[model samples]
Target: MRIYLPTTLALLAEQHAAGAVLVPDGAVVAEDDSEDAEYAALMTAADASAVQLAGAGRRVVVVADLAAEPAVGAAVPWREVVAVHADVEDRPAGADPDEDLAWFATQEVPDLF
Candidate 1:
């Protein structure tokens, strides 16, 4: 299953350093098994990310492919992360609600800091 996990920049940095991120209870997943279903999940995750924001940083959604359906609360290894969707820049507090997140490959995750 493919899941979208929304997280704050500080928590992400800690997880990146630890080599895995804990899947939140609020993580977003498609209603069905289909590529098309993932987009809505991603957008939902993005919106959830916005609520998690504090201070200043980009909203991040980590995209991971799992071997089997995950049980909501587990750790996703850093290696499992295939891509990331994040705000292009550190927006001011209360930035535009409709601004789009930029797509980035897993390899570029470090440079995002």
Candidate 2:
């Protein structure tokens, strides 16, 4: 299953680290374009195209700003869309650090001599 992460640099990095593809949103597309016409056209088409691309059974993770929620809501099917709040931290603090240490311990024997 492929996950499509929207254009938030931090989230994109995090998702990519977690092995997901970074999908650019309308705003990102618009910002990338130099010509006004091209920007407008892409902005208009982005949501629809994104939704179409994220058809049934595909896992789409949309990391859009709060303002973009309404636009995303209209285009993407709710069931397939996982909307992550932009303000929310990518990885919340207090994640299980002990689990990581335990896993590392198994990889190499401790020097108990």
Best by lDDT: 1
Candidate 2 structure lDDT:
0.31
Off by over 4 Å in 2: 1-5, 22-113
Error of 1 at 15 (Å): 0.7
Worst 10 residues of 1 by lDDT: 65-74
Clashing residue pairs, backbone N/CA/C < 3 A, model 1: none
lDDT of 2 by residue, 3-75 (tens): 2233333433354345433344433323333466533433343333334344321111242222232332233
TM-score of 1: 0.85
lDDT scores of the candidates, listed in order: 0.84, 0.31
Give the per-residue lDDT of model 1 (tens digit) for 19-94: 9988986798777877678778888898788888865678999988888656666889999998989988888878
Give the lDDT of residue 36 in candidate 2: 68
